[model samples]
Target: MSHSVASPSPKLSSWTHTIGASLEPWINLTRVSRFAGTMLVFWPYAWSLTMTARSANLPVARFFYLLFCGFIGASLSHSAGCVWNDILDRDFDRQVERTKGRPIAAGKISVPSAVAFLWAHLGIMLWMVRDVNSLAFKIALVTMFPLAGLYPLMKRITYWPQAWLGISMNAGVLMAWAFITGSIPASAFVLMGGTWAWTIWYDTIYACQDKKDDVKAGVKSTALLFGNSIKLVLALFASLMMSALVVVGRLNGHDLPYFLLSVVGGSIYLAVQLYAVDTDSPKSCWAAFHRNGFNLGALIWAGFLADYIWAAQGPALVDFARGVAVGW
Candidate 1:
């Protein structure tokens, strides 16, 4: 619809080709340069881990180890998902203005190349989780297939592909809880639901950026479906997301920090997002999407981390502080 019809990508500039072109396609294929998407994937794991670790009375050292592992797992899952999505959507991407030059879409790499790259990520993911509990390992494997693997095709048939993504993208909540606790209690599902709504809200804002190009390219998204009422619909989802967080906080008996920062701060942040983002402008939409990954996400995670750290190690920390004062 924009520029040339779907075709092989042209060569990079002379110096770029000689310098980084060899690895550029692989790099672009996984979107490693774009950290926001990876952060989106990691936040769910962080929120879930810190919240659950408090209840488990996990040691500080062990909690951090698990948190680090969650980040690596999130990176692998997100990178793999991006490769698979690119492989499936290359044809559709070539016609979309915003995505035409993506590695697979622009034909910088073959589908087989992308597929192989995908397996490399998955192989690493499997190895990374080999020591995790059996249930956690199985749950992680399940996310690899239909949950995430089938996502790109959802746009071909449904206007609410973001709904599918809401579930797939935040699945780390379940996997991480299972990894740490060997079980997914009702609260895990409750928190996952909140993260799911959160994904839908932000991703719909993201979809707004491509509304025109997507229509021309015959792609369906909530942006097109919600049309003039996109703001209202997103607001509703945001409210639901905030409500779920509050509900999860109650069920888990989270301290004041969580109720104040995660629930209150998160709601205020969403209100700012609602008031600020203009879906009609691509730059505005992209900025709002970035805030979901960086700003709003951090507030929520910080609340959980603060509560967990205080609850799990507050006494020990106080004693150490007293010892240091005496030594001084």
Candidate 2:
């Protein structure tokens, strides 16, 4: 008996191509494939969850579950925000070299389609957080309007659009804090401020990538606002962020490792990024901006995780490790 291989049907191939073509623009609009922004949005939520879990003595399994949900919520919401920004800024985007090829700017996707896509993501985000605390839900609802509605317009009217973006991005910190504690605490506000400052620092670097384009397009940004003082302004923000982190750790009673990793380590990582950044070079600015997600964010999360483990497991583990070291 002879066996023959069957070829793919033309109908199936056509269907696949059509689906891919339709989905590509939506994906590009959302920037879902580029995870730096998503991770940046998620980190503060993760930090809040870990801190709250430690304070509330929540079960480790429950902490992990909430963390997973936070990640999903952050990613979805960030993508939705990106779509909204693109929809509103399509005209300005077309005028900017860096953004000219964006889905809406390039005419690969229409405004109405992008709006529909935005709502779809927003719907999913609402569903994901439906079971969270009422306060978290309410805060999330309020955040969506300003972030998705107002952030895009900031660039048109203010040089501090990065500040608006910072506020938009760091809203998750408040949401996550409320989700875990059922109320926003003073420490949460402090963390929010810290996150806001950090956003200003990194996003200023990011905005530097399009400063010339922004000038030509009549757009405003902190990058152009700071101009020669950009590095000084970034340093100030970074210092403020580090100081706020220290205050947060003290407020939450995080141990020495928390300070070591999240404060000192994160500052060192940020310092390296700052030292290497060249405001005039788009490549340097982009690299420094993206590096914040992995470097500072990871260090802070690691500190929180370490503190959580030590708190949950007690001093017996620490003593046992010390005893082992002595024996060795």
Candidate 3:
């Protein structure tokens, strides 16, 4: 008699499934662990807010206050966006392996429930931004509906849904500037363009994971549009993204840290990711997309933060640096 070796994978998977199924349907519907995507929404807001704070010499207390508000706002909006996307794609999601188990697709949550949840996020977001400048409030409203709301539909009719996402995701760049400054600047629009290009860069990689499924499901994406030349097109977008950021730095008069970390380091990291990702492999594509949200985002935000702090307390930082250089 021989004892067959039972691999641990199935047991581990069963345990994971059990834990997953135990969660409340609403939480699962939100994909609460998609923090990466949520943070992507927050970063543009933070970066632009800091830039405006530095330029306007706004009080540090207020800056932090706005930053906190921005974080809360981003989380809510991203959740709402996810709910909206899921609602519109529930049928298509059922046909895709990666999305088939999603709450709506799996019959764990009804479309009505999902829509109600989406409304909940939107209502909270509206309340949070109630005191914002009217212009900023309108922009925020636009982002929630005509922009993010239209994103899922874009995939049905166009190959450039990523382009729409780029616009929607980075619209916060303008909203932050408007909220704090009461006006948008040419430089902020330039920054929006850069982040827009970046959204396409990362999302096309993300889309690559579902290329085959998307084709059969009649979905459109940049990954399928670029086809054999996907990498080439992505590289072009990468170049456009970096170039726009550099231009915005020039326009905004950002500190050397912005140039070094956000521009130089950012470009290097992007090149590495683009080179290392095997778009043909779903795992590789997902890894690259995740890294963009985590690592790449950090680089850009660090530089913006450094510039903002230096502007806010330049003389103090210089004095502190001098003391450290002389060993106190």
Candidate 4:
């Protein structure tokens, strides 16, 4: 009886199937680790914008605008970079355990689709930075073009690709300060330097995860090059970051307590990372990599408190609650 009117179920069109496959790649591209890394990079810009706004005595709305523009540009730029990296490193990615499941490496995504996504994100980033400041837009352009083209080559040639990547990440400090103030201040160099060291140091830790696979794949990274001496390198890099923070705080005329607070906070955070990390254990190394978020948070909080203290010309904690409430 059932065979009398048998009919086939409707099949999805080619376009529908294409779109379904495309979505998974985009979703995978926006991994949690990627999101966290992006957020950490953008946080300095947000913090700097708030400081500039407070220094000018502007309302929270103006500060929010700077933050909005910076976030949009940075996020779009990061999206493009991620897609491009996946495309370029697809073959190498398949050799690494953590990266093996990525959409591009898994063959779930087409290279043409990834390229289209990259171009779209780049266009959006360009538009966003244009609205912020010409100087920032220029910086974004400089950072994007060279970094995007050359970053993939790092794995092929240099063990310190993370250091080169640091330059790209910390360029945000200059972009943010110039966008808000319309000029590069002395503070910009100090902050940028600190950000650079911090990024390189943390990224080195992250690279540890891929060290074994990377070596097997004939790729280079600091994790392999530094070998057993990574801890020493990380400690030195972290020290440089803290030193930069101290110098910047002083130049901005922050109280001694402000400088001390940041140094101590950063040091404690770094100690937790350096002391507890077991480079031989991939699990421990991954944990250490994730802990950088806390380190960054400490630095941000210290900077915010210091800036508020300078503005109030009083104890750092005096206006802590009020400063936080007003987005300072």
- TM per model? 0.90, 0.93, 0.91, 0.83
Model 3 earns a TM-score of: 0.91
Candidate 2 or 1, higher lDDT: 1
Query: Between candidates 1 and 4, which one is better according to lDDT?
Result: 1
Best by TM-score: 2
Lowest summed lDDT over 10 consecutive residues: which window, candidate 2? 140-149
Model 4's TM-score against the true structure: 0.83
lDDT, candidate 1, 43-135, per-residue tens: 998999888889988888998998888888888888898899888888888888889999888888998878888888888887887888999
In candidate 4, stretches whose alpha carbon ends up further than 4 angstroms from where it belongs are 1-22, 32-34, 309-328
Tell me how far the alpha carbon of residue 219 in candidate 1 is from the true structure, in angstroms, after superposition.
Answer: 1.1
lDDT for model 3 comes to 0.90
lDDT per residue as tens, model 3, 184-270? 999999999989999999999999999999999999999999999999999999999999989989999998989999999999999
> Is 1 or 3 the stronger prediction by lDDT?
3
How many angstroms is residue 67 displaced in model 1 relative to the true structure, after the best TM-score fit?
1.2
Give per-residue CA lDDT, model 2, range 161-233, as digits (tens). 8888888788878887788778888888999899999999998898999988899998999999998998899
The sequence of per-residue lDDT tens digits that candidate 4 reaches over residues 211-244 is 8898889888888888888899889999998888
Off by over 4 Å in 2: 1-15, 322-328
- What is the lDDT of every predicted structure here? 0.89, 0.88, 0.90, 0.74
Give Cα distance to truth, residue 94, candidate 2, Å. 0.7
Q: RMSD (Cα, Å) of candidate 4?
A: 6.4
